[model samples]
Target: MPADTPTPDEVWALLTHLVIDTRDQWKRAVTERTGLPFSRIRVLRRLRPGPKTVKELAHAAAMDAPAATVTVNHLEELGLVAREIDPANRRQKQVSITAAGRTVLNTALATPDPAPASITALSNEELRALHEILGKLQH
Candidate 1:
């Protein structure tokens, strides 16, 4: 290790800061490019995998039912998502991303991430090391 290598406590602080900063940058980029809120984008992304009920979306998105419904309402108005009554449960509503939603997500993904470009400038060896470290940390 380098003599100036960060201590574990320093590494933890840096990681926390990096996560918050990256999330803020991502939110700015998504909003600037798509004019959609981060929460709505989150819902669309979650729905991209498959149809889900409003409650499911709420739970997954860390939102309450009413908040999820509000977000869904706006997405529906934009024609980016659709809602249908669940056949299995009359009281439930299933939400699914529309073709337009996928297109929007694709466009957003294609947008330049507004985070520090320096992160992407890392050498291949550094990138590999970072990825390996993160993978191990996750478990």
Candidate 2:
């Protein structure tokens, strides 16, 4: 690396591409293992933390509210997710993952590592450095 090279912003763009590419690959692997589309898997994964309104899920998943609702409807049909009336807002509903959904997520997690040993070989320091660098890029 040359000190007189491109500015930090240029390096940040490259770093963003690298991170996105890696995430896309991981999403693809999860989709293949679960037989669920990447979008659906992402929605379910977001709900793992807790139930969320359709609007909240949409924002978290970086999708429009209408699209998120449609996806939630499909998952509902599969018996993987359900909607509950929001206690705070009687007119609103919150989506939550069912036991079946948890089962599917657990199975996906249990799937043997399809990634190469090189990924597993990274030391804690290297992993922390990558995380910190990505965090900076995100901000």
Candidate 3:
């Protein structure tokens, strides 16, 4: 198994597993710390940039519009998010993370984790290589 001749299937499988496991673990940790469902946290993170309509958020989050609406409703109940009338489209509503949501996001990010230190041990060059390789797969 030479470095240049690594098996593509093996690489893809490893990457896939890493992604799923990382997401599940991170979601569990965030939910434990914030007492908010992982789905709600995801919705809040997506809204951090700016307000987005339910349809937009659903598409971005890979969820259906109806599901997004339900999640948004729950988040709204928790005071973590808000819905505003879309000025451009009177019938449409846009969602945004409230100040409370921002605080939750910050707390989630600040929560201690022992895994990151091990991950950070990789040299800058190795990280750059990994990033470059991963970036090529997005297409």
- Per-residue lDDT of 16-89 in model 1, one digit per residue for the tens? 98877777877788888999888888899889889899889999999999999999999999999999888998
TM-score for each candidate, following the candidate numbering: 0.76, 0.72, 0.75
Task: Report model 1's TM-score to 2 decimal places.
Answer: 0.76
Say which candidate scores most in TM-score.
Answer: 1
Alpha-carbon RMSD to native, per candidate: 3.8, 4.3, 4.0
Residue 72, candidate 1: Cα error in Å is: 0.6
Tell me the RMSD of model 2 versus the true structure.
4.3
Off by over 4 Å in 2: 1-8, 110-139
Off by over 4 Å in 3: 1-12, 116-139
Tell me the lDDT of candidate 3: 0.86
lDDT of 2: 0.85
As a TM-score, model 2 comes out at 0.72
Off by over 4 Å in 1: 1-16, 114-125, 135-139
> How much lDDT does each candidate structure score?
0.88, 0.85, 0.86
> What tens-digit string does per-residue lDDT give for candidate 3 at 21-109?
66667778888999988887788889999999999999988899999999999989989889999999999899999999999988887
